[model samples]
Target: MMRKTLIIALGTGLAVTPVAARERQITPYIEVAQVLTADLTNDDVLTYTTLAAGIDANVQTRRVQVQASYRYERRIGYDDRLADADIHSGLARAAVRVAAPLTIEGGALATRTRSDIRGAAPGVLQGNVANISQLYAIYAGPTFGSHIGPVGVSGGYRFGYTKVQAPSIVSPITGERRDVFDDSRSQQAQASLNLKSGTVLPVGITLSGAWVRDDASQLAQVYEGKYGRLDVLYPVLPTLALTAGVGYENIEISRRDALFDAAGQAVVNAQGRFQIDPNGQRRIDYNFDGLYYDAGVVWRPNQRTQLEVHAGERYGSFSAVGSFTYQASKTVAVRVSGYDGIQTFGRQLQTSLTEIPTAFNPGTNQLGQNFNGCVFGAQGGAAGNCLNSALQSVSTSAFRSRGVDAVISVTRGRTNFGLGAGYANRRYLASNAGPGIIIEGLEDESYYLQGYINHQLDTRTSIDANVFANYFLSGFGPQVGVYNIGATTTLNRRFGRFNAFGSVGIYNFGQDQQRSITSIQALLGGRYSF
Candidate 1:
């Protein structure tokens, strides 16, 4: 990893280079920041500090330029002193303007993260190992313009190779053991063109298209998707106008192998699996498919007001959503949105989205099959034999939901404040098994609401408060509600430049599931820029 001092030192040297070019100049800069955090939970004491720094430089010469950057960060404090950092990412671009006004540039990306802290809970983890999606990429872009009509085109493409380490855990039922599946990698590319009517049409248009793919062994292979968009803008008067657009997308998943562990076992011995058949590889079998389309409109009567409405639907999945927003002033806005669809509710998905289910993970799902301890059937035979029976019982149904949101704020020079609220209700049906027959699971509904506000006392002082709460109503389960409140203040600039600040906040949550927890945390940090 590249340290801040090293990067800054290098930049300083590069900036002082005696380049005898009148049209070329080198710009270099660096930023360093550190944070100290503390946990105030009654049962445990957790403390930590993080330090981060980055160095960037840009050299512009005539019609060509180059830019590069490097960054490093460390996490220290609490029960461990470990650090994480990104070595360095460097890129150089060369472009020449042609008589037709065309230019092109290409670059590369290389970054990785390493940690030495132990694993724990979310918001409380002390390690960077939890995130292993690290890798490199190559990218390029081109732009063209000419007298060959009144149109211009610009586009870019990028391909990357990433390494990901899935969490080491088994599905608790079918006893399917977890193992390194594949070296996952994803690809994305995009292009767009703009049209202008210098002496003809009074409006302009832009068209764009994009494609992406993510491959992860038998799990998420064939996750390739494509998208397209068209945008139009028209001016009714000098300061008034209208805008509209439409978009479409498609995504699909491929079939793959499924792994299963021996009965009563959660993990297969590394040595045993390798020797069992010398060719025995685990696999999950299922397909996932879907697509989506959307259309939107925007109207701006004047400078201080605007209105937007959007609608979309997903085919095969039988789902649709609509939303609208109105902004009356600089600090006040309200939005309403709703949806009716079937959403995959679990983390470990088993089959294609088209295959919906009633009870979660019908029989022995990916998670269940991996966790061999639970008995999914009465066969009492081999563990893998009972997985099919479990999946056969899965079911699916249509779900509908509606929600409304609003925001208000007051601001004057150095002081600013705002509050917002939102509410939503979602209902869906599920299926469950009975003594001698399968029973239809009742429809379930949940409601959620949240709000927040903040104010600046002066150029060097500020305070903010916020709250989030939600309630769930289900037919098979009791009514449940959860809420949390928090506030923080800074004696220095809220998020100053080259300054330090400290803050403290608390949160509490309760649910009908008999689970309750409360937590408070404090933190202080400082930054320096050049």
Candidate 2:
């Protein structure tokens, strides 16, 4: 599949290169990329490296454009003793202007991955396949202005299908089959309206909504969601402008004919942000939503000095942070910030695995149906009755969380660097389900820190590097700690009248108590103008 995509992209580029000579309208572009890396953690004997490469091409004329991309990555581990990882993905997009006020675009994307453990201990082989396909959308709106101003609308409907497969493993004790096979089909539609102000306001406001219908046998369902936003730009003064807006979003998921309940239906998202800017000298922004809110201000006292303040809230907890930045010279700048917050806890439950007994069948997947088959079992000697009891328990109280964040930055020449550190403490008690279920035990705290930097040679060339590390004292379930690092670079240039650009980044994710992930990515391509 990767080879075929690359071949088609190369062919299209060659076909569109001579459009200038033929006096025909055409645009062509291509990009290629590669990456290599290794892990240097506490282990010195086990080394892993990844390689990724890809190509992208685009061809467009006055009324139409076509784009395609393909990427492949492979991981070698244990001193090149094992082929540990692989990933392949592809994308295609095409758009055309059907009329003066209407245009259409569509695309398809797919990816697959596989993993194996050779030098490791045992039982570490894993693999999965993911595929999605969708059709294009055509949009139409008025070409002229409305009586009040310009009014326009754009929308599209998409039909998508997906299929996934995973390996089956036998329970260490029950010796039952535990592989997974899932297939899903879904359709989604979205539309939005933009009203330009010839009226009281000079800014435009847009309202949008979307709906998705997904089917997976007995798990088939429909989700409906909508949102609206009003935007306006007000000139507070010649040097300062203020932007204020608010929006409301809601989504409800319903099963076959049933009204969506809190457990089954998700609430719509409610969020908005407001901001004020005085050119580059000072800026203030307020951001908030249903669960969180923050207000930030930046003041530039001079060309070389800056001060900032940030405050926010999460539920019952509140936080505040302050920072200062100073340019020591034309080539160097430094900054520091401090933050703190408080947290509390209610009740939470730990998630664990249980074995299904011969009398009951647990079915499969998230939407899998349950039927009489085998009874279930748990770890150690605490199987059967003990496992069943735990599953039936519920909690009434909630957990409390509190945290603080601090940061600092430094920059020189074409390079800039940053450091961030934070801490979170949580308390969990017990809760009653009102009826019968009750939960118990869960108290923990965690701390984390990360740092990164970027270097840019010029507009067409730059590099970024970042690293993240996290740790937790103790938690109810799997460890929520990991280390991540990534680097990306882009190259852009022009040959005659044509222009091209491409970028590639590689990310490394150290395994956590839950799962481990590692991925290599690359993209490169260019375009020509006629």
Candidate 3:
């Protein structure tokens, strides 16, 4: 179909091929699983069977490379109240090098996630359409870098698209329908010129300009930002440098008014979103233009360790950002990153997809279901496991988000362990004169911790274990806070080209005081791979 081809072409054009071993693999597989789930709070039990088939591929050539995974699933159950049979979950990226210094890079992701922050936790809400939504995002662009004599020039332009599919959700407090994100288009462009130290002068000088914009269909929202900066780098030692940059930035976000009938009542569309007025005037929601500057230090004593830290001011607030990566030994790696920015749910998803490493080990459950909330990758700066954090509540209003995430991986003999943790805070921004006024001044905060361990029982058998805990605070709905905790373990054995697995998990979710719901599930499954 047209959709399948677009994913391939765009993924190839936007991927950055990392230095890796010579690997080319294409695996097609099928699986059948029996599942039994119980809801302790409501004393309800459901049993089902799922049949799934999928392909996993990685192909690398001299001029082209690609990595992708796709699957189709069907659920058979007597109770189909929440059995969403169509579940798509995967991440892909590829690249094609047309010239020595020029390449097209891109990535794509498809998954289902929660649409509202106030919805029940996903730990036990599988296939619940009221709280779940399907998402698809793809991005690709061309990048080129070359030196004209002593001056180095580089530039890039990227186009991104995101779509969300689900019905409108009703507020628990007001019992009224509200709009969620529908889709968005984003564009980013950057160009820079650099002159290294000692080649033309005693110090290095660089000039760069960048622009980014996002247009969302819901309420016809638009956000545009532009900035130009001049940076100076002074070498303090062979492996260390002090850097500073100054720039001017302009940013604005605008949206059109929601439609209203002659009776002065807001109009609601069939999909639960508010209708937009065709004659509505676009009103500015946020506007800021001023100086931007930062000072930073870069340290790289060896190829295995690197660190960059910066402190600056933006949008009339003090800002701090940094990233660190360290390869302790052949079996240990650590990475940490801090970020501050304003973004909508759509933009956040696209940025997270682009950051996912081109090389990764797909995370799956005992039922062979992907989107286990995270992706595991090799040691590097791009090896962020923050997709789990980015998969939070999706709202129509744009918000200023701040967060920091850290990941650590270790391997010891026959066992491997990984840990990841993060915190995020969002303060919503809404137009006072438009439909967005309802969500103004709303705030939400989240903290998450996750850990996993896997042990090889033998040559063909292993056990995988994972545990997670999260706490969330929201001011958008009647419920003030919620906490979710869960643990799962799977035992696997392989026989030639066939594999079998069994898993058990217990999840608990609590909202408002001690009002809690508990879910327990067990699964048995087998797969044959060719």
Using lDDT as the measure, the top candidate is 3
Steric collisions counted per model? 22, 39, 8
Off by more than 4 A, model 2: 1-56, 60-62, 71-86, 91-94, 111-149, 158-164, 167-188, 198-218, 228-250, 254-476, 486-530
Question: What overall lDDT goes with each candidate model?
Answer: 0.35, 0.33, 0.72
Kindly list the per-residue Cα lDDT of model 2 for residues 1-530, writing each as its tens digit.
11111111111111111233222223333322222332233222233444545555555455654545444546445544344655444444444557765555444333321111001111111121111111111111111112323556655554544443332222221222211113445454555566644444565454544443444321122333343444343444432333334434343332222123347431111110011112212211111223333444445556666565545554335655554545455333343434332111100001111111111111111100011111111111111111111111111122343344343444456666555555555553333211111123454454545454556667655555444444434343333443334444445565675445554444444435534445444444444443
For candidate 1, give the lDDT of residue 279.
34
lDDT tens per residue, model 3, 52-127 = 8888887666677667877767767767564546666677876667898887878788876666665554545343
By TM-score, highest first, what's the ranking? Answer: 3, 1, 2
RMSD of each: 16.4, 20.0, 4.9
What TM-score would you give candidate 2 relative to the actual structure? 0.37
Rank ordering of all candidates by lDDT, starting from the highest: 3, 1, 2
Q: Using lDDT as the measure, name the better of candidate 1 and candidate 2.
A: 1
Highest TM-score: give the candidate number: 3
Give the TM-scores of the predictions, in the order they appear: 0.46, 0.37, 0.90
| lDDT score of residue 337 within candidate 3 | 72
Question: How would you encode candidate 1's per-residue C-alpha lDDT over 1-530 as one tens digit per residue?
Answer: 00111111111111111234223334333333333333333465455555556544444444554444434445465444344433333222234344345555443333331110111111222233232222233334344444435665544333333332233332212223212233334454555666752345777676767666555432233445566776666666654445555555564433232233465232324411211222343322222344344444555666444554445554433333443434444333333333333222110111111011000111101000111111110011011111111111111221233344343434445544433344434343222211111123343443333333345566766555444344434333323333323333344453544655555555443444554546555556665656
